[model samples]
Target: MLDDQLKSQLAAYLERVTQPFEMVASLDDGETSAQMRELLTTIQSLRSDKISLRTDGQDARKPSFTLQRVGAGTSLRFAGLPLGHEFTSLVLALLWTGGHPPKVEQDLIEQVRSLDGDFNFEVYMSLTCHNCPDVVQALSLMAVLNPKVKTTVIEGGAFQQEVTEREIMAVPMVYLNGQVFGAGRMELAEIVAKLDTGAARREAAKLSAKEAFDVLIVGGGPAGAAAAVYAARKGIRTGVAAERFGGQVNDTLDIENYISIPRTEGPQFAAALQQHVNAYDVDVMNLQRAKALRPASQSGGLIEVEMDNGAVLKSKTVILSTGARWRNMNVPGEEQYRTKGVAYCPHCDGPLYKGKRVAVIGGGNSGVEAAIDLAGVVAHVTVFEFMPQLKADAVLQKKLASLPNVDVVLNAQTTEVLGDGSKVNALAYKDRATGEEKRVELEGIFVQIGLLPNTDWLMGTVELSKFGEIVIDAKGQTSVPGVFAAGDCTTVPYKQIVIAAGAGATAALSAFDHLIRTSVPQ
Candidate 1:
């Protein structure tokens, strides 16, 4: 049940919505579906004149839903009740179905209008996933903006066969046609960028036979992009290739510590990176993953970078800036209850659980810091650690201990995420000392373990650290001449955006110097 405050807020939003729409909730008599129906009924009562609700009560499946214009054709689906962080998705969807347009960026609208041919996107998500709605909303708005595009939101748990076929282990798994588009919280610009035509596909295929570039950088994180802009400014033929721009920064929720900018989110910074790089005439080969590296000829020869698509791109010099991904807890319900009550980013989803009980998993600096940060927003914070003692720095530990609403638990191994077959309600763990299973009733959980660098494809090609980080000298040159690596993928100690961007500049200058020394006077 919504509190009076929330009810009043929603009532205000619904007052302006006058278009009639049908919310056809496909249901089973299960608790989850019943709860979903009740939620819809409640919302309907608030705007009974504009929004009508009914249930298809016997599908034997999990909670199923569809919201459509009363008379138009149906293509969008809300496979599960959009609850948890996805509650926003339901409200936004209702607005769209009721003839209210979304607030989209003008440039994004232009890109959507530029898309030609028919395109349909199927986004698989769970009601518990906070990251899922971003993708759904972006695609949903795209469908609304352009008649050439359409989208359907699938609930992963409700559609077992579809999930099995896709081998989905995470939420917000987007599929364009039959192939998986991308996963997690994708940005609106990225969705627009992926509408690659057949011409672009053929062009990428021919990269193997193209002339060599002066500098070719792999990875599109802050480092790779920075290097590309620098190299392009030097008036040399430059190219930047990566699976995605923004790298790990795209997953970060906030950027208060970054210099200059007082505050920013990952997606916003990533978009700025894209805009900055696109400002130059740099040849951006996106959606390409570096598979291996080898010399096209012998020593002092142009290098050939093999990509995942079997395309071999030739370059005089290369920079590696592939970054890292978050380290998952790998526990049950961790994925199932993600965004429902389980989250990895304290900065991204912390405010959503305001005044609610939450837990922070891990005792290292990251965990302790998350606990400290969340203590200010949440009603209470319980810190769980696998080790007997906290491993955080004394300063952070002291700060955490000072919090009145914080509790520290040592030697606790998180075993399961407990939920009511929907959103998370409690978390279960085992106490190492007492051999007792303990359950804590909390509304949210934040996991802050560590990060795993992306460098598996460079195996046997360059010298790598035991932990799989690439080895580089002060000049950013790898074991192979003309090959450079930077950012989290290299031996750079600090792994922050500011540090990576600075490293990129250093690498570009180093590559330019190497080119100047090696090139014969024309």
Candidate 2:
């Protein structure tokens, strides 16, 4: 069950086990149980005398083994076999329990320490997910730091019943206080904020009393950040409220088409945007989701921006740069296996599947583009489209046709995602015409159907296109006076990062112009 090279790596990692570590399990007569024992034995042999595993010590919750620091109720446990991407999770839990706490934000540590009651965090992961480890490590660290918090890292494959019951479609599905927190790649703070501790509600109440602003930009993605910077440069009272900045770009993996910069990740670029906004006098309020918008008094008066948190801000002018989010297929296994074999941005997760077979779930421009780009890196590429013909531009379709490793399947509806509890290994689709189900075996699935503007809140408040995109004119002015919009959230024709940034600057200039011409001197 173990190899020489892997054993060597495990041995080197265990050298840092400054303190004794133990794995307690209750193994009976079964293949899974027997295999679990063998895997543990192999690991123990590799670590020499530093690590130990006991098969018949105790059974606290069914047939399971608990991992903890020698004697303490470390509150870190593993329910199933820790293999695949979770192998690193097991290693991290051991390392931290042995006394090496990761260097994280002081605020994060405090949040963990300030817990009022016992909290159980369950992070479900697959062996092949690249983004699962971070969630696992984060929750595990939180458990280790706070005695009131315990974390169970479950390998999605090891426990099929729980996966089905929980409707886990994506990996790294976090459960906080026994409720589904979030799925896919998510920051710890994002997950933690979802906890109903009354603190968030209180923060919302506080924001409800915000003062009027010269310019208040909603949506904190690239457009919002750029607008904030430009507005603040004018030395005006500029405020930016967003659920999270960087918008759809946050969902993007690798961003190489941002003009001058050759390459940068989505999160990295977002951080840079935040830093730029911070350099100015902009009032940056993150994690504040806009819930409603309307003119404070008259059609041209200060616009009232109501937040989902119950806080409100009044500004003379507002810029809507809420941006857009990836349109999910909403099929089974799509969410549970995300970052596992299921992926969205080819640019970001493509490198993870080098030399492996993958599938593109749409035949549109983005889907075809992803297939073309991935073909050069992966061993093979398959494109599945529900339509009878590819919707990609003629140029892109021609490019795809020329790729030797790429193949397209028209009129195919993705029926389901097939995986082995840990990672996706195949996709099931039905031929639209024949209604016959077909399955394609591959390592990765990229869904690029299209984008959905994050403008649901603006529903009737502002003029919107039939597709829900905010409509804006050449000067970034929306149908509503004293309001402007930019980036993917608007009908701006394009949705690239550079375009969004430029749009943001334009919207800010317009808002500044509106402020100078209309607002009374302070």
Candidate 3:
């Protein structure tokens, strides 16, 4: 039965509106008969000028109203307690009762409204992923912003077969207009831009080659490419799926230490890894994102992965080699000056500031490391530490102190990034100690603040640390049974390429073990 407080609340809200409306509800099986009787009685008491109430299964003949039965037989089911953010869905469902769709941004509305073609987007996500809420919110906001766009959010681990078949290794993957977009926690601006510009659509169309394999790996970083090589050597049919074939390594300018290769460039190292993976029969799907995953129903466990292009792939197992991206500064000019005078990874674009002035904003290990690295390449490196002192390791602090080109500014904060349209020229900062404002002329600024985990697409399906890193057990078991996580994204206390790669290997091996146990005949 409706609670007394809820009934009063509903009545008060109805009194404010003058238009005629009908109340439709999906009844719970356990208390339907009793609840319906109480609800009908309550509606009878509020028989006013325009409001009306009807029970379930009674209004099928009426075209204007619907009392849809939505429990077990319905396509949608509430997986968890509908509290907090989940309550938003309930409000939306109520608003739909008035036959009014949710509102969306005008630009997004226009784009979707003009398109007569069918468009569907299924986002794979986890709950604990830091970026998952943002991704879901962006898509949901888009739907609200554009009535023409329909979206479905799926929990990744629960749909393992579907993910494997679809060759999706990353979260927050968007399948739209029969194509895929692979930014985990994409900004709304980017989503709108892609829909409006069609640049992403064109890129998806360019990579149309297809092939078959037992295991398909996405991401050409150390994880994805390495999985392909390892899987191939194990006599399994392997293939690789990458947006750019070499992953993040392709963007690196210099790699001072990568095990056997002491001194190597990012592209050269990527080439070597690509060659090693390609030596086998592994097919590479370059510049492509897995758009959708459709798992086979039969017990044989075959999965089908649909790409941004029309091509499809069949695989028994799937390895996510999709690596993490450098975290952005989120400042005003950060986006505009990207690659022009602003960079995330010091190793990737530090040399561009050679003999020129540069600033490193952060005090963490990465920030300190970047400052130290830039000190050697650039004429002067000014490190702006937010905290009182450098938070880097003792060794790094000693090294940075010894360098003549490096200057450590304690308790400093960046206020604004000023750039001259073409590139960055200078920036304004504040000294916390002396309360003095200052501006420094520099050719480049590297934001080495910290990294944001790429797990935001997970949509609350797994456990995550407070900092948004995925929580995994010793063997890499995530909060979910079939799911495993590793690397910088996980709460492993370290964010290094070597650590990420090693974690990937552990996750793969754990997945393999789980596959063997699950696939064994009863």
Candidate 4:
């Protein structure tokens, strides 16, 4: 009973409404492969009622649902991916198909509508990581809000080989316009700022003083190096300020485990990592220290850094990776015997003491772990604990007790380290009980006391935890908005080299996201 004109109009409406639904259904197949076929069939059967589709088939029945498209112009986007917490995304996708405008905060929505350039976004995430979901949601919302933006979510497991090939060891990483963003969860405001302003791309460029970079990372330790590499790889103008280039890695004797690289020596491994950064054209300012960071309130903002030789450098963003120095035992002969017989980090120096007797000082978990680790590499390991009993975990105590080459001396404290000019020869100790005094002959002494964060120079710029470590959120963001912190300097629990590297990557990506959101007009 429909006229030709009416049928033509209905056909156009059906096509407009059904095209986006079909595309969304296709995506669902990938998201839930097993249930996709059945779900699609059921949804399609209800399409007539769900949508006001006028059909002439003899099997026509009452439609089950209605379709209301939202959003106007070419700025339409799917708010959710229809996966996990993305249920709302499905609704938004349908709304986009109907050529209607979405309801968003008036001011923010207006700003988004004004964007005109191409914005490419890709978020990297791992299945096991807890913080990735939040980051994914934030990114999805950004893509939905801006019509000029196209977003993709990459599963870490699916790209495991690629990630390993690129030496990517972090989760919740966001890459926009080839520049990396957050390694973990970040605030929406920060992400928007980075994207809008092109700050991240500028940060990745590695521009010279004549054309200063947006970001300059100081130090070449695991943290610093990671930041530099990530920033530069993202096409940001980035540079590194390092003293002696490799930082603490030069002093490392061996690196048994650092995620991808299972076994490596400190210097050689550090050199390889540096080469990776260099490959990406990151500028390396060797033998330099950023003595101070003074902020400049310019258009892009600038940080004036005073180098050691009174040379001043300027940049838009500054990353402080000036790692901490080992707190040496101030006992007179201790300084003279360093490397010869005194060492820190038993895992790095244990091999050198093989088949030789060694003394481990301190009673913390690190001391106990070192003692246990050294027992396997040395002829004998003597642990000197000032406490009445070992302060390590009960499990560690049991393990150490089981080791035939390990011995624990309770209520004993090292008074001085005595050594021949060439090497450490022995240690003088006093026992609290019975006022007992003893001297033990050993080839090496491992100090496993603890670590101090390198935040002394930071003053009050950022919040510091009770232990002086920088306080950062899951995304490596400090209390300050523009500034971020990572690695051992931050309050993240694990202090392994891999963890630090991951943190550094996260910080750089988060900073990039901030830059992007700020660069664009919206």
Candidate 5:
């Protein structure tokens, strides 16, 4: 049930509904079912003239409800209470089902409408998952856009038996036509591209036809966004080609070190970054991954950046801001058991291990924070640190020490992950002090070691440090003339968001300086 403040907000949102809809409930004599009834009744009370609630329905899953537009073929179902992070998804579903147009691009809308197939999508998501809302909203919007598509969002917490049966240890697990489609955060564009086979070709053609930009950024995280904004302000053409707009920031949970803002979550900050970049006249090419880079043959010649889709974009100067990703534990069985019980995000996957023992690999801030957070939901947490002492802050270590269910082990090196060919069952490590091999029986393993730069694609192309980070000077210039680098991919000492953004600004300014000094080839 919603509070008075929430009800007031819902009343205002319901006014956007242009058409009438019904909430048909399929319930049984259960506590969750009773709560579902109350929630539906409360929602129907907000706009009784346009909304109606009906009980006495039969579906395999109790405590579920179906949203159907009156006299329209659009319909979707929610098999659990859409509270917490999914509340926005539920609101959008209601509005979209009632004929309220979504704020997405018209092209994406048309793509969904044009997709040919009978798609029955089922998504298992946790309420606390920050990434689940994106997938849920995407699928829900598709179901509303095309009649042949139907989506059912199931809350994994309410349906634990189903999650266990499927061995789903992650949130936002999507099943299309009863087959696993994907897991993790997915935007509407990504989903449509997967469904529409010709999307990549069309996008490549479109990108290839674009004109040369004054500044071309290779990533769309904090650095790329800042560079785009700064370059666009210089009255020159600017463009950003990115695999995903958020980059590694999308996987981040909390960000508090940014100067201006006191605190913000990763996804929210990423959205704000995209919005800020959109405010400028920069051309943004999303879902574009750069596979290769070619420097200009002569002064004033355009540098070419090739995409995985065969599209080549030319620019006067290229700013490589491709960010980093979570470093994986390369031990045997680690890759084999990924998503089967080995997860990188404790925030997203921690709830799945309720009352189960899990291990956190690392003793830094991320690892300690993950262990502290998981201690409340999981039965026990064991932390393995490769160093002799914890690298986490004093405050964090103090908090971690206070938890009774957490055990910290220093000088422990992870050797291998043990699984039964399907899911993780234990983790093997070596004691550096005693040279003793130890194995801990657990259900899940969260790796929080560090980050690996996204510069593997640029090997032999740029001057890279021993750690594979791009070698950059104070001005953010790479060894290759006309090609600058910034952010986590570069040799920046600190990998904080604020530092990346400042580095981005510096790169953009340096690129402008280079443009002014270089002579135009006649």
Candidate 6:
């Protein structure tokens, strides 16, 4: 099933295998089963001595495989073809199961091994999802580390019945012990923190003990990474505290607009950004969210930034690049039905509604693009625009119109999401031109209206615009001296990746300038 180049790459990766492992397949007589067998056979052919494939297994799924270490009772399972975005997850699982050391921190490894619960994880994922691989890899690594923990990565497209039964309308829906655990992208640390319970207390204690920093950046998107790199280059004590490193960039699918780079995926670019920042002396604290910001009482005084875990971080200067998130439809059922039938990401969750009708609640570039992409996989896509006309570019509008299964309705405002107390069955809207309400039956609603700045935490701490975005001057300095803001969270007109990176650099430089002109609080 793999191409020659892919086979060669797999062969090279498999060379690191020091121990033997077996791939036990439980497949029926079907096309997908045949493909699964071919994939397993090809993998075994690469390292014949280290790997073995068997089809005499009985898994619940018709086409599934379990990778088990020879003597160690550790194992992980894949219920469908681990291709597309999950291919890396599959490869990592192979190497990790075959005794190749994972790139995770030694502390995290030890913690996983020390966990006492009988954890069984099931991750429902889509192959097109850019965010699924991280979760899959994390859970898989957990399963490999602790024999008590068992994980099964299920490809939603290949297991549509189970997905429907579970009411999973989104990718990367994680379940622990048959109950919903989490949905969306998650890091290894985040997962472990949830399971360990005391992890947050330990982390808070560790963070509280750290010394003051010269430049402490809050956020880990493009802007935060750039700020960290620039600040670290100045030879100052630099630190970054982020809720999730890469931030919203991880949810983005395709990013062709990044200058210099012709085309690259969002996860790929985010990884590159992390790698670039890691090259510097920046101390990155991932999975730590900023809850409050306290500006220094006097110039050159240390600014105190409080985290969600009650850990207060003091720094000479703080850069707020917390960024923005997808604006949600404020309708009644929208929040209640999230992940059940309401989803924000079309590229990631489109396959879940294959051959089913869905609605896009905006006529902007993102909305139209989502409609265009969903038309290929879904039965029909209806674009709803609150304005009289679409705001998307002429080229995108033209492309959207050309799609046979896509329809656009202008002057329509989404009112409420309709559901059966479990999953969304329809959407309520108002026809602004006619002053009448309307409802459309559908399996999903993709909200792509816009973004809301993540500056709610800085409400009483700094000056904010009417829309809650951080107000900044040309130098990227906030209302508070030595406190700077950048990226989507600020009053920047454009929210492009390139613009955020540039703004980050500007904020860092401005923070440095503020440091030299003011006296250090004695």
TM-score of each: 0.65, 0.69, 0.53, 0.50, 0.98, 0.99
lDDT of 3 at 252: 59
- Residue 203, model 4: lDDT of 29
* Candidate 2 Cα misplacement greater than 4 A, ranges: 1-109, 125-141, 152-169, 175-181, 298-300, 328-359, 369-382, 386-406, 411-446, 520-522
Cα error, residue 131 of model 2, in Å, equals: 5.2
| lDDT for each residue of candidate 6 in 407-479, tens digit (9 for 90 to 100) | 8889998999999999999998999999999999998999999999999899988999999999999999998
Candidate 2, 405-437: lDDT as tens digits: 998999999989999887888999999899998
lDDT of 5 by residue, 1-522 (tens): 799999999999999988898999999989999999999999899889999999977889888999998887776999989998899999999888877899999999999999988999999999889999999999999989998999999999999999999999998899999999999989899999899989999998999999988889999999999998999999888999998997888888889989989999898999999999999898999988899998897434789999999998999899999999999989999889888899999989999999999999999999999999999999999999999999999999999999999999999999999988889999999999999999999999999999999998899888999999999999999999999999999999989899999999999999999888885665
Best by TM-score: 6
TM-score of 2: 0.69
Better by TM-score, candidate 6 or 5: 6
Candidate 4 lDDT, 351-402, residue by residue in tens? 5455789989887777888898888878999998987988888998889899
The root-mean-square deviation over C-alpha atoms between each candidate and the true structure, in angstroms, is 8.6, 7.3, 23.6, 20.6, 1.4, 1.3
lDDT of each: 0.80, 0.80, 0.60, 0.63, 0.93, 0.93
Worst 10 residues of 3 by lDDT: 72-81
lDDT of 1 by residue, 171-237 (tens): 6778887777786677676677567444335645777767789999999999998999999999999
TM for candidate 1 is: 0.65
Off by over 4 Å in 1: 1-138, 145-183, 187-210, 296-300, 329-343, 347-359, 372-381, 386-399, 402-405, 411-445
Q: What's the C-alpha lDDT at position 10 in model 6?
A: 93
